[model samples]
Target: MAATITNTVIDLSHHNTKPDFAKAAADGLQGVIHKATQGQSGVDPTYAPRRPKAEAAGLLWGAYHFGTGSDGVKQAEHFLKTVGPDHASMLLVLDLEGNPTGPSMTLEEARAFVTHVRAVTGRWPGLYSGHYVKELLHAQKDPVLGQCWFWLAQYGPTPVVPPAWAKWTFWQYTDGAIGPGPHEVPGIGACDRDKFNGDAAKLTTFWKAGGV
Candidate 1:
């Protein structure tokens, strides 16, 4: 069955402030996935501190790596080393949007990267990308790539499930500021907002399933 989409979450990076995770949690966020590393070299300085703080505040913690079309093995190594095996209790995502200014990842590169990360971590990292990129990659039929849980990014009133996906595990519904409304969260100002496919109890069960 398709998991029902509900619950609010947020993602952060160096671009945002050192978040007041307590404030975020009090504001009712279920989780936070932060940028851990990018390409083969860049690491988010805040990730080290923010991770523990987010956990302390009772938010499920996740980490993501931005693909730069670099050596897949090296990039995966950097990501794993930075986020560390202990900290990723919720999910590890492969930010597969590719470089905005440069070329996006080819299907082969995406597969290689995800494959290497899964080999090392023993868990398949969730695949994150926009709808267009999902279509470009032909994700539904690619044997190696299709195994990942999809985190679809589409800005709209409602999220559209990507091709071949029964449902998306995570949906990045907006990059705008979350706010004055009842659903507007504090601490995370003008950042990307996401939705889990299920409610809190279901999310916990899904997390415990270890990205299966």
Candidate 2:
């Protein structure tokens, strides 16, 4: 069956302060995905501590790695080492964005990074990228990478899933401040808001299934 898309979620990093995950959950967020590592060496300082807070809030917590397009295997190794094997019940995302100071990654490089992470974690890492990057990856027609789930990033009223994806598992719809009235998020100011492709129960199932 095609997944039902409705619930809201949020992705945060060290750029934002320690959030009140309980308040966020009360405010209608179903899950939280945090930036755990960047490149092959950079680690988010808040991830280790904040992750537990998110979990305690009864939110499905996940982690992502910002790709540098360098050595995919080593980068995956770094991410695995940092997040550890305990994340079997949560999502694993590969954040593929344009690096302002680095060269763009070829499809092979991207696939290698994702595949290596999957091999180590035994969970398929969801691909998170904007439209252009998604299109580029789609053109490669990679069996391994193309089979993974997608988290499409677009800032508008409606999110457009890339043609390569059968369906988008997550959609980041707003990077601006959003909430009831002008309050932005309860604890996080000017955050990226997202929509899970399913409801709360399905999200819990997805998390337990390791994102399939």
Whole-model Cα lDDT per candidate? 0.77, 0.79
Q: lDDT per residue, candidate 1, 87-140, as tens digits? A: 435688888885886666666777888898888778788988876566674546
Q: Candidates' TM-scores?
A: 0.88, 0.89
**Top lDDT hit:** 2
Q: In model 2, how many backbone clashes occur?
A: 1
- Each candidate structure's count of clashing pairs: 0, 1
Instruction: Report the Cα lDDT for residue 24, model 1.
Output: 81
Q: Per-residue CA lDDT of candidate 2, range 19-86, in tens? A: 88888778877778899998889899999999888889888888999888688888889988999878
